[model samples]
Target chain A: MRRSRKKQVIPGFGISMGVTLTLLSLIVLIPMASLVINASSMGFSTFWETVTDKRVLAGYYVSLLCALTAAVVNAVFGVILAWVLVRYDFPFKRFLDGLIELPFALPTAVAGIALTNLYSDKGMLGHFLGQLGIKVAYTRIGIIIAMVFIGIPFVVRTIQPVLEDMDSQYEEAADVLGAGRARIFFRIIFPEIRPALLTGFGLALARALGEYGSVVFIAGNMPFKTEIAPLLIMGKLEQFDYHGANAIALVMLAFAFLILFAINSLQIYYNKFTKQ
Target chain B: MKRKNLITLGIVTTLLAGLLTGCAGKAAEDADGKAAKAIEITNVSYDPTRELYEAYNVEFAKYWKEKTDQEVTVTQSHGGSGKQARSVIEGNEADVVTLALGYDITAIEEAGLIEAGWQSEFGNNSAPYTSTIVFLVRKGNPKQLTDWDDLVAGGVGIITPNPKTSGGARWNYLAAWAYADKAFGHDQDQILEFMKKLYQNVLVLDSGARGATTTFVENGQGDVLLAWENEAYLSMKEYPGEYEIVTPGISILAEPPVAIVDSVVDDRGTREVATAYLEYLYSDVGQRIAGENYYRPSNKTIAEEFKDVFNLELELATIDDELFGGWDKAQAAHFDDGGTFDRIYDGETQE
Candidate 1:
């Protein structure tokens, strides 16, 4: 494998690899390693008890369920929004496109506050929704809304470039071959963008899973209900239970890693199947 | 290629050396300044005391200057009480801490940053000012929520922070528990049931006192807010005719203590200033600032001066009393993981 390597256009591969490794180690790996080290110092039984506590488990359930729902929602609407932005031109197109990135730019806490205000029973939209007997803020629904607001940018940004880069000839050829619009999209267009969509889905899911600041405001933070895992960690830290907090965090990190791994493998399998 | 790598390595080493020397030079300058007529100390405090300290710091600085002829700069860091204490334990360089609860200071004491008996370092258990848990209801009190029993009555929406994360909320919980203890005549089962109902009425358990106030005042979700006395007064002052402070007949005396972080002050050689800074909190101007900021002054005379401003009629339960024993015992029995608070929700979830 080493001998089969081809030369790259970009030189100084060694330097670039060194820089990347150094930055990654400094920024990510070291802190994560410390978390692992701290969690491991707590005996396995205590760590198990901390993570498997009823309230902790409930927090994990709420966080994972809300994040998954939010990711699915983002995947669907993010695609539609990205499709509209990339395929069509309209008034304020640039403005609308710029707005997609607003969630990414705005602090998550600000988004949480703004979304809470917009969805609380007395809020502008919330009042109308209240008339319809729909409640958003301070519930699981509020958590999902905050997650979707923050995760939408990840999905839209990821899929937009993929959609832009795809050639129109494939669609044209499929259309000419007597395929309907739906068939062309599902059979031809979708296969090409599935990898990007999965990536976006993974990113959004991962982001939402760890989101704390935004969701806490809207979560109402009731145990066995709206309490999220990150808030549980915060609670543990406040109690000076660093070991318990690290244990919970370690479990969350492990779950997030597993989900990312599963998505990555699925993407690889899809890429291979499409190539064949 | 080897020569180029060598050149790059040499340049990097030179830059690193230059950066290290720059930092060393700054350290030297700081060391020199430590002997000069200027000093700085950091006061790490809890959330609601932001205004209290903002007013107190300026007065303390003037007093310090007048006394010692030295210009003192006091940096303030505010956040959740326990979080602030944890930061101090993890080395945030806080010369002194004025947090929301005694347990937070106890945690720091356990961490060996402050002395074991730091509570008695100054007057009033090192708590120059005190507050209590009170109810902040809407202007007209439409719920007719007069006391603790009204909270547990059906259909009354309540808002308070999570006790596990908020020191003030712990006091709120203890206050409610104290009321239950008295009302139920110390019947454990009845008290637990009463506490359960009170928690069940809570619509939003925000992570901090300020957030709970926001949930009550800004979001307009809950019918009443379990708030710090100072916080309730501040909200009333901020939005007149929109909210009213309802001092419950029974509440917990929330004595937020202050202590010099021995390790940090000793290391930074600011022990004198840090000690004086906290000491000044009991002074006349300091007491006045505390009163103006709605915190009950620890000084009897100062407290008397603000008797009209504060509610002195309510019976305030002390954490150090037999009810809860102390902050440490109260924390372990009530707010700790799988303690009463957790069990309350656990029972609810099971049902």
Candidate 2:
């Protein structure tokens, strides 16, 4: 036993490794494995047919389009919000910082309801927009709004710490070299935070893609129009077509993974380009 | 150091108390010969039955205690009817499922959770009370949404849940189908055309009946809401002048069914109590409670007393009747994937 034992810097390594693997397998891997097993049980042809159905295709389209739009919106506003919080000292600075995480804590159902109530035709903002014939609730715009609500915190939380840790010495050096505000931001500040921004955008996109509760309440759930992928999965589950539900969910997972992978690759390329 | 000692002392005392309670509970469960045995049953139901079952559970517990002298505990889980049924099929351990439609209970049967012919197991086809579909419009009948025709008329924003996910929306769809079939001399194409128009006018299709009501009432999203008679009545009662129920000239009689999950009851050894609990729904007290909740009770005497609340003399079709056939056929032809609903909305090539 002494001859076979390998020397390690940390003791209890075997036990710790065993515990981590067991916990992960039980909590995450096993459930995901079941989803794969269920989807495979439907057979490849059946899976292809179910995922390629017109309604499922519509769900995928609507979910991707809305999530993309919402993520873009969140990225723009999240950067601004973090910049202000880090660089400026307003009266309600601390309160505003705390408020950024409200969406994370408030139940998505309540957010959906409150958002619907605010943007409906009879609501204060909606009533004014109705005069201009611009309907928001029960439309794709409403779905995007709900998604933006749920996704804002992801972007903000991911970028805020990086922004807070950003060195001010570089900006002072650029200023000494007589670089303008716009030039310094583009050549110096932006390159430093590019990786964090990409990570934030990826997280916000993933969150919006899987968002169900808030989107469902405001999506209007019109089958070829405003329906989302998760709602289609729910509809299938309700119909007792477990195989079909699993097939669609697997497709969604694949799509989300592809997008996240693409974002990660882009982030790597960004880092490579900036370093050179 | 003193504060640290106090914290340790408090934790020890709490742990000891928890241990004592656990032992006491185990002893109570094991002490079955002399003392009243405590039993718990879980009743999984649909969204709108929250109020109905809360009142019924209390009454049933009291009745069970008086009858068997054993303490009875009843717990309820409520959500969308189809979702609730899906949970039971996924092993929710529901001793009884009081869903919004017989179709949902049949789903449980299909899952082998309950036996076949569960409808015949209890009185009145296992539906203690029945309700019909109706239109709930803004107060003063704005837009003059009186009957089915008005729902499909141009510029009308109708509010109803998706039939694919909601039992109430199935009733609303069938009610519309029945009206169109009768009005157009039973022409199938005309009925489809009419239904297409009606759905085209649907401003928002919620996932569940209660959600549709909230969208229509609270969010003010639509002009008229197609809803269950009981839900419409409850809305009228709650928001007195904000909305009013419009009993259409034709509608579908909705039978929301209940059944004991045979497998679950057998596993829990609560079959006797579960059976008796459901049978109690057909009893006199249960009928009174059902009527009080705005449901059209199956008890003839009690139903007659609630005529003023449910007074309607319109033609009503049913899901099990000739037009729609039965739940299985209806589920296949209409709400199933690539069925009529998908054809109309998503333009699926029907299989």
Candidate 3:
């Protein structure tokens, strides 16, 4: 008998791969390469001067701090939100689920203005906060809040499906074995969901890194204080310093890539650890 | 099932093709040809000129039609002056740029979009109208704000855009500097200290003039808003009794300049019409419109006609005076990177 051929369930990997490669190159690789090339065209000294300037450095610090803080906050709260939606049923359960995606759907500028209004000294929320002597709008806290608003969906959406698909049998077994709630969560559920949490955190962090419109309104944009990296890049461009803008943008892109790489490695390590 | 999937795929592909071609055609029509029945020119301007330009576009279109009998359309794009200048430098096709400050137009000239010495091409150094920085306080003049001093006084919040980004804010910054410089008899250290205090009291720094206004009026974020004179007037007009325009004893003469983008108009064969459109800004009708809109008209007669509206008698400092020198020197000493602004904010004196 002739050698039997095994038919594939999925069709045309070659065509699909070609399409994926073309789209990625067109959308991502080309633009990133152009940015790097443009940044490098400015001599090394100029690039150094642009990125290492104190104001630019401060901007980078603010952006990284707020993004990371917001991402971590999202990771914790997002998991709780996902868990609640997945484990509980309530009136407007579907509505709350739908509302979780509002940030993704809303224009960032509108969200920013709305948030600024809500947290301003005279705003409904801000009025009570003012009585406590804590200023939220126009401070670093405001930047983090805005980032959180923009980034919440990234974490929730990332981990929601994982939580839903997870079987409750492991938790049941743990409980039957006289395991405490904390031990059950940490020993069983935590290991399984850690990879998804890391992915969500990374996504939220990345989204916050490039955020602009909302932050500007609430940032108060004090140079070397509340200004973020993207605003600095925009400031350079506004001053007609294209090379300088590119230099700063290239630095941000590099830093973000490095961060995302580390997060992915952590995710892979956890995934492997859980598999065994 | 196979036939249904094929039909669905066919319809989707056709829709995508149709959408793509439609966009391509729409873009092509923008710069398709020169003098194709109707000519369109883009005026990239700074914030606060929106209403002025909207009125001017209608007037200019009428004049262009009455003179050349060719249908003409005027489109406007407005933002922070420096930002608008950057867009033009990045190859935005603005036939004319009417910005809040001349330095922005100078930047475009430096980029070689317009010929050198564009200031001499039109009257008043190519500035058709002038404005000043004034205080827009909530009704009853809360914080007892009178001049630049009160802005920096204890427990008062001032709302002004960041000078690094806003042209109007630069005017606002310099006006404060001029006030303190004069008060202290040009003591640089004292002036720097005063600026630091003033900025410390700035509750929020918006990126543009309009954004600053919104922060003050809508968000209720500041006590006194350092604003363009026209903006202050417009706010009082829009919300009667909610705000008051307080003219300071001395204010800087903010000459918002207008210029033709020579390269753009030349390439589009619109040089003649574009030039006329900007020159129309200095005409009697244009001057009257400018005057009525709270801008100090270049024409003395027209400006006097609207004296009740503009409060034109306020002593105003010109940039050409010995104090600020000019835009070039001022831009370097103050607004440039690592300049006075950065030093003041960094709490470092430039020794």
Among the numbered candidates, top TM-score falls to: 1
Query: What's every prediction's RMSD, in angstroms?
Result: 2.6, 6.1, 4.8
What is the C-alpha lDDT profile of model 3 across B165-256, one tens digit per residue?
78899999999888988889999999999999888888888988898998999898878999999999998998999998888888899988
Scored by lDDT, the top model is 1
List the per-model TM-score of the A chain: 0.96, 0.94, 0.96
> Candidate 1, residues A4-87: lDDT per residue as tens digits?
234445666546555555557667999999999999899999999999998889889999999999999999999999999999
DockQ versus reference, model 1: 0.48
TM-score of each: 0.95, 0.92, 0.91
lDDT, candidate 3, A149-216, per-residue tens = 99999888888889899999989998999999999988888777888889899989999999999999
Better of 1 and 2 by TM-score: 1
Range of the 10 consecutive residues with the lowest summed lDDT in candidate 2 chain B: B1-10
Pairs that collide in candidate 2 are: none
Ranking by lDDT: 1, 2, 3
Query: Which residues of candidate 1, in runs, are more than 4 Å off?
Result: A1-10, B1-35, B347-351
CAPRI tier of model 2: acceptable
**TM-score, structure 3 vs. true:** 0.91
Stretches of model 3 off by over 4 angstroms after superposition:
A1-11, B1-35, B347-351
Clash list (residue pairs), candidate 1:
none
